[model samples]
Structure formats: structure tokens, C-alpha cells
Target: MRDLLGRPADTATLSVTDVDAVLGEVAATTGSGSASRRSELLSDLLSRATAGEQDFLLRLLTGELRQGALEGVMIEAIASATDVPADLVRRAVMFSGDLATTAAAAAAGGQEALLAFGLELGRPVRPMLASPADSLDQAVDGIAEPIVEYKMDGARIQVHRDGDEVHVYTRTLREITRHAAELADLVRGLPCTSVVLDGETLALTDDGRPRPFQETMARFGSTREEQVRALLLRPYFFDCLHLDGTDLLDVPLRSRREALHRVAGEHVIPGEMAPADAAALLESSLDAGHEGVMVKDPDTPYAAGRRGRAWLKVKPSHTLDLVVLAAEWGHGRRTGYLSNLHLGARDPDGGEPIMVGKTFKGLTDELLAWQTRRFPELERGSDDWTVHLRPELVVEIELDGAQTSTRYPGGVALRFARVVRYRPDKDPAEADTIEDVRAMLRG
Candidate 1:
């Protein structure tokens, strides 16, 4: 792990293409073992290995490691080792299982195969980063830099496709493939012989308005995939990392967008033309009741697993009343209050509340005590201070839209999530919907 994640813990100092080189090297060295043999042997060894799993894994291969090894960094390394671009590596890790497979393909088959693998997942792995977009004036000042369109409230979806197979992973990279078949079918129809796309799926309400992002999430939680088809969820394509037989990352965002448009066609996210006047697009997206536009520099292509100014999502921020369904034990001063709360939205069709995100801030002492005494009631079971609840109550929580998660049940998770109030009068059915959450994306 040290070899993979050690250097320049400061992401600012790292090159966008570094990780891809590392992955290419490792995959090339894995030899010509069969996938089944590799899986069996690795799984067994992993089951018995004693050196902190990640540590041993990295030692077996030549790469860096660190305690909070950011996914983006590892992704870069994998792409580097495989001679593939960061985007393809990012997509593979995000939507598929076993990084070794991606590495092997990139090593032996090269970037085109990696692109094909990433596109196999229903939605391409989304490349995300903490937004660095400046205000409208700041954005306008950099007009010569070139920018692309981006929507606000949609869920960040990673689609992977392989031959006839498709999978939709949430932000956490969990396989919610079986749960989202309608979307799978839609993505399967893309014109590309093989492709992987990075984008968002927004929900439109019955009134023709975008709904909260939570509504879209609920649909993701449903075992019933068709629920979203009826709800009118529209996928807004933003970036393409893998094309028919090439990696777009080596190209520019302009090229990637062109490829994205060709494959997605009518399904391509609807947006205005450019040299897109940033001010005009800003006004257009916001005034349309959409969140805001993402301004992607046309000259830059996808920087897989890295967050740079290459793409910027813009929108006025908004919050919502989400529920607190689970509580994780706190650390330090919050050691006893159960600081980090696992939040959920009401399930309209009678399923467990789907997890949205976690927050340790925003709880009053009274509310914390209430939670301490009351939260256990919803527990399916408990382990020490932590309690896993049935996720029934509706708490008025708020936050920016969704992102991926590593520790949540539903694949996608939220950002800057906090509590505003509890909804005593509202039942789970009356609470926020996935569409509402998607609308927040545009905020």
C-alpha cells in the first residue's frame, strides 16, 4: 500500500496520470493465470492473511499505501500500472469487482479493453472531487479556459457493461445492479459497440419539475427496478471516459463530450451550445429551476478518480429534511453521544429507509439524549454503543446532493449532511423522495 498511496499525500502535487501507470505494471506482472484461479487463490489468501489486509495486498504488488488511501489516488496508480488512463481505471474500480481484472486487461489488452470493461457497467464510473468552482464572476473571468455543461441535482451513477451484462453501482461502489434493471436496459442501448459513461440520473416529478434526490435514491433501494421508469428518471450524460475502442481521457473534454453525444444521442443530457457563455448558462440552468451548470474545460478530458477544475458543477445550494435511521458510536469528546448519525429518507413503498449519508454535527444535547434513549427502539439488533434501526422516523435533515459512499448500504451517499428538524407530523410516505434529492443536485 505504501508504494501505491505513500507519495505526495498532498493530491495537489500528484500527477493525474500517475496511478494508471502503476496499475498497468502490476497487471502485466500478474502472469497469464485464469480469472477463476486468481479469484480462488487471492480470496483464500485474503481470508487468511494477517498483515493488515491492505498492507499485505500492496506488498504482494509494488505500490504505495496509507491509512486513508483516497480512492482517487489508488485509481490513478492502477491506471498507471496498467498503461490505461485514470478514467478507465476509475470506472473499473467504481463499478466492477476485483481490481486485478481491470489491471490484467489494461496490461494485456490495453486501454481499449479497459474502456470496454468500464462501459460494461451500466453507467460508467463517475470521476468526482471536492468542487473547486468559484462563484459566477470568478467562473466568468476564466472564460478563455473553456467549460462544459453540468446538471446539479442528479445522482452520481457509475455504469459498467461487459458484452450483454450491465451493473449500476452507487457512490459507495456497491453493486445495486439487480435493483436497477430499467436503467440497465436504457444504458444497454447506447450506440457504441462498447462504452463507459460518467453522469447523473435525475428524477422529474409528476408536475414536470425535478424532485428531491431522495426520491431517486428510494427507487434505487427498491428491489423493484421498474419504479423509476414510471417516475420518469432522465439520465444527464456529462462525461465519457471510454469510447468504441479508445480511451477518451488521453483526449480533451471536448472530444469526450463529442463521443458521449454520439453514443447517448437523444438521451444525451439536454444543454445549451458553447463557447457556452458561462453567465448565460448559469442563468439558464438556475432560472430553469435546475440546480446549476457544470462548466467543464473543453480542452481537458476525463481525469479519472481526480477532482480538478476540468469539470465544475454549479447551482445554488439547498437542503432537505432527511431522517436519522442509524447511529454509529462517537469518538473523542463525542465518545458517548453517538456523534455520527447514519441518515435515511422515508420509503414510499414500505421498504427499509435507504441510507443517504453520515453526520456528527447539528445535534442538540436534547436531541442527542432523545436519540440515545429512543434510537435503540428501532434497532434490529445492537452491538455496544452502535444501534441499527428500522429507519422509520422522518427527521428534517438537509445537505448538498449525493456522492459515492464506502460505508453505506445504498451505493450513493450524501455530502455535508446535517439535521434541520424532525418531522413528527410526516409519515415515511410523506417525506422526501429521490426526485427531491436529484433536484438538490442542481441546487
Candidate 2:
């Protein structure tokens, strides 16, 4: 081991069972009252692991798998290995609500056991996500019909109700029920005994207008109930995943929406179906002080945990393709994420990418996971503040404009920059140059 990896191995042997034992220890110790005892147990496990094994275990422990295979690849592998249909495997995994357990069952009990997995109450399924559309017309162009709704800028929430017990979950499936008892009461009063609702929740003014995103997030994310009492959250239901003892996962959006209207009544999101003109609707939505509009295909099923083209979100903003130079460590809910990104523009003279600004906005947990897994692969080095990476990945950022600044050598800084998406297909060379940004300053 020393000869191959240039690192001395303290342990002579390791096994899969040993790793599992260590995991059990860590899980048990994490909840213990003694901090010193937890640290001692963790340190002991680290000492027992070999260098290579340590790296693998750390990745697994932190949920930062850089092996290039996420759930999609795992499902494909399970299908190939077990001689089961890939679609069936996917459905089973989705229904079972977990990959690890579903794969084990498929491997152990074969198809018979795999077929048993189905939707159950109180167990949260992942929510469907949207892809960004450049314009409202572009969003409605391809679809046979589109449901256009005002896209509120707020927290994505999934509310699950079974009798008197109500659970509210964030987009990441973190249960925040205690912090939102009032919301639970609102849901309890809804016209259903059992239901699952997908929607957005945010602080609204007394006139029923939506507040700023930050103010909403502040109330939604606060641990102190009294501190956030002044800023109350209102929910707007957009989709129904289940209702009245029936599963709606395999049904079309139109059917689910019908159920949503029946169950949520006045709480159903405001929208128009197959409008004669989408541009007018977009203008109205913007004029009504919404972020923009969401254009959804009525024929598509609810694809949990998948970001597909069935739902399109159109936000009005100018975007630029820039390169990621470095990232800083995150905190709180963003603890393990590469939260803050150092953005740079392409040098017109073919030199190194030039730094222009920094941003930590518009990031979802899924995107943060992608960054945590991929950034280390492109790592050049690291200092105390940031993890420097190779300028190989391009990211699209939306900003108000650029301004002259002494902060960066590029002579300008992005005003209120936020990420739109990562551009995997584009190379760093093709990124917008400093000159293009300066042009924005002049414009």
C-alpha cells in the first residue's frame, strides 16, 4: 500500500462487514449526550481504516459519491444484473422510496419481492422538479397544451396528511412539522381524510401579496417559533400526489390537478389552461408581481425526484456563461455543500480565466450535491478559504448587470449574481469573455 499510493497503512486488513460495523458505531455515537465519546469512537474508526478504504468510507459517509454513478446508473446496473426489466426496476425503486433497500430486495428475493413495493402513507416520495424556459412563448411552443400559473418565489413544500397527523416537508424531505403547526392546522381543516399536496409556501403581506424570498425563507427556516410569528406563511397548492386512499403517481397532471382542486378548493394555485395567448398571461403574471410563470404539460405523470421537461419555469433575466474558479465551505442546512462559487469570465487573449465576482444564490440541494461530488475531481489545490478547481466547467449565471470595481482584475463585478444552471456541454473557452461583461456595464 505504501509503494502504490505513497501512504503507510496502519491496518493490515479490512472488510465490507468492518465498514458496516464502523457505520453502526458512528450512527449510535452521533446521538449520544457525550461529545468527547463520539469523537473518540470516530477517531478509533479512522485509525482502523486503511488509506484507500478511508477515502471510500468518507465519501459514502458524507453522501459524496464521485464514482460517476447516481440513482439512474444504479437502477440500470440492478436491471442488468438481476435480468429484470429496467422500467420495472425504476418503478419499483420509485415506489419503494429507497434505492439501497430496493436493490437488496431485487438481488435477494428476485422479481416477486421487487413487485411488492408500493406507495405508503407517511413515507414521503420525492417531488417533481422543473426545467428553465427562456420565454413564455418558447415554453408553450412545443406542448400540445400548457397550464400556466404564477410562479411564486418561495420555499417548495410537500404536505402529507393521514387522519389527524400532518407532516410538512421541505424539498429535501426534511420534516419541519413542529415549526409549522399553523400550516398543519390549515391542512387538517382541508376537505380530505388522507392527502398529499405539492406547493410553495412563503410570507405574504396583509393584502395577500407575496413578500421577498429572503423574508419568507427567514420565517420558514427559523427554529424559534416566536421569532417568526410576525411573518406567517401561506401555501398555494399546484399538484396533488395522492388523495382519499388512491395513488396518483402513474396518472396524468390533468387528473392530479382535478383531485387537487377538489381537495384544496380555494387553496389551489391560480392558473389558466391552454390559453389563447401565453405572452399576455406572462405579462399579467409579471405585472401582478410574481417572479414569472410555470408552464406544465398536462399529459405527463408525476416523475418524483426527476427534473424533466414536462414542467417548465420561465423567469425573466439575462444570463451569462461563466467558469467556476473556486468554492467556499457551507454552513447550517448547506453544511457540506460547496456553497459560495468564485465566478470568472473567459480571457479574450486565451489566457487564464479572470475572476469577476462571487455568489451563493439560487442553489438547490440536488445541485449542491452535484457540486460536492464533481468539484473535487477537478481540484487543482486548496487554501484555508477556498478549494481551487480547474477551469473546465461552465456555469450560467443571471445578474442585474456589471459595475466597475477594484475588487477584481477584470475591472468589473457582477451585481446580484445568482446561478441559473451548470453548462456541462460548453467548454471554458466558449464562456462569455470580460469584454462581453463590460458591454453589459455600458448597456
Candidate 3:
């Protein structure tokens, strides 16, 4: 930033037009031999910028502008400004996959324009997400008619097929059709001429057990055909959003399941319609080396981009009594507290605690205030961002599982770890050992 600032130019103010011009020039130099020219343009813009303008420009360039205008807020704003219903605007955004386009439609043609934004071929729609359930019983009981399916620990994929031309997208709507040619071929071979499917895909072992998540991610990230062929991804589709010429987004889960079964056939994920069968499916999913089951309400429509009670994910979490080795200062709402904790496992050989993972989840405001006051009292040393503790404070952590990691001395790290509660009654010596953490990876 210092180098970019260089020397200030004699400019009173910088306009949006000036910044847009510089950005346009930078983007235009993408295919040309203009490295020095692009740098010169950026430097000039920075030199002409005021302190506030420079900060805004840097944040915009780095995609860190944290203005409170989230999607929901924007949707409401668009509806109020255009005199359209907020629900209509939100649905348009979800189907169109772009807020700007939805806003333009609302402004240009109002309700009629927004209503026309239906599911489009080759365009990905936002995925429906599930809320975390405490237990299978709770998930089953909460729904009127529950449909249980295995929740695979893999990358979420949205596949669209328009005849032989198939497109595959990640959960974020980024198209990876070229990299996932095999997936495209698989979708193309389906019976439907035009279809949209949402599912999870992962690599499998020789015995058909799912591979580690990292291995599945490697294939998704790679463009090499050899690597993609070697670690072929197997997709287990759970929902069919559009089948043939009909859109199923507004349809109930039961009807959607029928469409999915007819189209995806054997690729349809194993599921049962009865709430009584949820327990058996969960046990079978776990025994098959998969994650727990997703309990879904069979009567609810597919609510894209919503984490409502229509779908609930239940996983058998593993808890471990771990030690807090250090903590970093929080940000935003937790600004003054030592929010993020560096967790460690006890070493059985009388050595220092082995650093495993860190977490800031499940901490209530009361706990945050208590940690801010208590962690400093046990502080042995300090740094700019973290306060090192004396390894005497034991915290109970609940996690999904453990994965192999090279970042820590223990060679394993906790996954989806959150604070269950502080084990103030337990001693650090009685904490879980590093060997016990490694056993999760082996299991």
C-alpha cells in the first residue's frame, strides 16, 4: 500500500468514473503485453486518491467491502424502490442467479418482469441448504412426513442437461463443466432431454466406500484428465429441480423425488419416505462410512438458498475434552473479546499439548465476556494478535470428525469443531491425547 500510494497528486476529489476508468483499462490489458501499463494506471489512481478513497478502492479490489447491504437487504430495497413484492424480488434473484439483473427486471417491467424469471437451461440456481439438527429423533419428529437420505461428505454439484450439452456447477454457481467432463457425460446420458439436478459427488475406494473429502476436492480442483479419470467422482443426486419441460422448484419434495427417481434412476441417493425408517437409514449410512442422514419434510417445496426447517441434517458428533493453548482477538460483534481459541490435545509422553485446531463457534455472549476476562489471567506470554495461555484451561469440543493435517504437530485436526462447554471441573492432564485425535482419522 505504501508503494502504491507513492506521492500524493494535487487532486481535491476522486470520482467513481475515475476509478471505473482505471479498472476498465486494467481489465482491457488482460490479453495484451501491458504489465507495466496496468501498474502505471493503478499507481496513478492510488496517488490521486484521498485517504478514505484509497481505503475504499483497496477493499473493493480485494473483495473485502463489508457494507451491511446483504442479499436480503438488497432484495427488500429493490422491492421498496420498484414497488414490487419482496418475495417476488427474492425469488427472481434466486432463479436469475444475479441480484443486479433481478433489480433491473423489477425496475424495467415490475411484477411481470420479475415473474418471468423462471429456471433457465445452462444457468445454475442457488441450492437449498439444510439446518443442523441436534438428533435424528428431533429431526424426524419436527417434520409431518420425513424423507431420510444419506448426507454424503462431498462437494455439492448442480448439474444441468440440455440435450447433449451438459453443464456442471459448484454450490457457488461457478461453472466447472470443462474440468468435470465425466460428470457432463453422465448427465448427458440421462433419459431426460432437459433436466436440472442437485446432488453431492465424491470419489470412492475400490470397495465402494467414500474417499476422504480432500481427495474428492483434488479432482474438482484439477483440470488434468489423468487425475480426473483416476479419481472418478460418483454423484448421488438427492433432488431434481427441473425435469423434461417442467420446473419442479415449486413442487413438494415427494413429487420431486418421483421425478428424480425416474430421471436419475440408480444414481438417486438411497432414501426412505417413512419417519419410522429414519433410524435404520442413519445407522446404515454410518456403517457405510458416510455422514449421517438428512431428514427432509416431504411436503415442503424446494426453498433455494434458504436454511429453513424444511430440511434438517443430523450427524453423530464426536466430543473431545481439549485444552486452550492460545486465543486471538475477535472482530465485528466480538471486537473486544478473545473469541477464537487455539485448541490442543494432551501429549501422553509428558510433553507440551499438541496443537490441533481452532474454533470460534457456539460461544454465547456471556461465554465471550467470561473468556475475555479469564483467558488473560492465565496468560503466560503475549503477541500482537494472540494471547498464549499456560495450558491449564480445558474446553470440551464437539466435532464431526478428524482429518489428516500437516499444519499441526499432531498430524490430525478437528473438523467442524465447536465449543460444547468449558470443562472447568476437568484437569488439563485428563484431556484427550493426540493419539486419540489421530484415531478419528483412522476410523
Evaluated with lDDT, which candidate comes out highest? 3
Return the clash pairs for model 3, or none. Answer: none
Q: Compute the lDDT of residue 13 as modeled in candidate 1.
A: 29
Query: Which candidate do you rate higher for lDDT, 2 or 3?
Result: 3
Which residue ranges in model 2 land beyond 4 Å of their true spot? Answer: 1-7, 10-18, 21-50, 58-68, 223-226, 320-396, 399-443
lDDT computed for candidate 3: 0.88
Which has the better TM-score: candidate 1, or candidate 3?
Answer: 3
Off by over 4 Å in 3: 6-57, 65-70, 77-83, 104-109, 223-226, 332-337
Query: So what's the TM-score on candidate 1?
Result: 0.52
Those runs of model 1 whose alpha carbons end farther than 4 Å from true positions after fitting are 1-126, 143-145, 160-165, 224-229, 272-276, 317-329, 332-358, 361-398, 401-415, 418-443
Model 2 per-residue lDDT tens digits across residues 1-443: 12123343677576777767766775777454756665566566666777867666566666764564778889899989988887778878766667888888888887888888877777777678888877777888888889998887778888999999999988877788877777899999998999999999878777777766656667656887676777878888999988989989789999999999999998887788898877787888777667778999999998765547799988778689999999988854577778799999999999999999999899888999999998999999997767999999999999856667779999888878999999989999999999988886521
lDDT of 3 by residue, 1-443 (tens): 44676655556578888788889889888656588878888998998887767767777787766554778889899999999999899889889889999998999999999999989999999888899988888888856678999988889999999888899999999998877777898999999899999999989888899888878878867977778778988999999999999999998889999999999999988788884667889999989888899989989887666657799999987999999999999865577889999999999998999999999999999999999999989999998889999999999999989888889988888999999999989999999999999888723
TM-score of each: 0.52, 0.69, 0.86
Across residues 64-160, which tens digit of lDDT does each residue of candidate 1 receive? 3224456666667877777678866766664455566776777788777766653333544435543545475554455465554646566777676
- Please tell me which model should have the higher lDDT, number 1 or number 3: 3
